[model samples]
Target: MLKIVVGGQINKKEIFDYIQNYYGTENVKLEIKNDLDAVMAMQSGQFDYYIGACNTGGGGALAMAIALLGVTKCKTISMPGKILPDEEIKKAVDDGIVAFGFTASHVEQVLPVLLDAIDHKN
Candidate 1:
């Protein structure tokens, strides 16, 4: 199972919907708030990765990654361009989870690059 926490926007259903399309709603989760809440949720050992959304894609994701570093082996994937298809984002999260071993700091640094790779299908 892959867990995703959503940031930005109140109605996070759209993001959830997108993610669910590929991974199924049961696999994807949503937390509609800032990075703090996202990190807290991750600390509970419920999710594998933290997925945050922002207009720029750095602020919320960075905040969550910083909080989870060294504590939770987790990573974050942000869609800055907002062009990522649902399946692509899902695959990015999955691949990140595999390659990074749930290290939050590593995830933070790799998320942008991961998204780019996903976008380009690299």
Candidate 2:
């Protein structure tokens, strides 16, 4: 199973529910965690991926992951009004970015593509 954690400043429950409902529990497992704990867990290999959201995408969403996991391991896929193209998101996964952040408002638009990319990666 692929283990992923919802580690963001906002919409943790909603994120968890979306993944659970869409992906089901058989192949993927998700947990809601605070950003710092989520980063620590990822460091310890507790999760295969880290996802977070904030207004800016890089602030509360990715600060800890970037600090602990290094900038190379993390990517901000979306900001307030800017979201990366789908190909770029896939490329980030191929490039081995284990952590992803995006604006909370973009979750509905971003999760499907992001989750599909991750699913393909696994």
Best by lDDT: 2
Residue 13's lDDT within candidate 1 is 49
lDDT of 1 by residue, 14-87 (tens): 54455456455564454454656656766776554555544444454455555455423433343443343445
Looking at model 2, which ten-residue stretch has the lowest summed lDDT? 21-30
TM-score of each: 0.49, 0.97
lDDT comparing candidate 1 with the true structure: 0.46
State residue 85's C-alpha deviation in candidate 1, in Å: 14
Query: Number of clashing pairs, model 1?
Result: 2
- Model 1: which ten-residue window has the lowest total lDDT? 98-107
Q: Cα RMSD to native, each candidate?
A: 8.4, 0.7
lDDT of 2 by residue, 1-118 (tens): 8999999898888888888987898878789999999999999998999999888998999999999999999999999879999999999998999999999989888899999999
- The runs of at least 3 residues in candidate 2 whose Cα sits more than 4 Å from the true structure, single-residue gaps closed, are none
Candidate 2 positional error at 70, Å: 0.3
Which parts of model 1 have CA positions greater than 4 angstroms off? 8-11, 26-34, 70-122
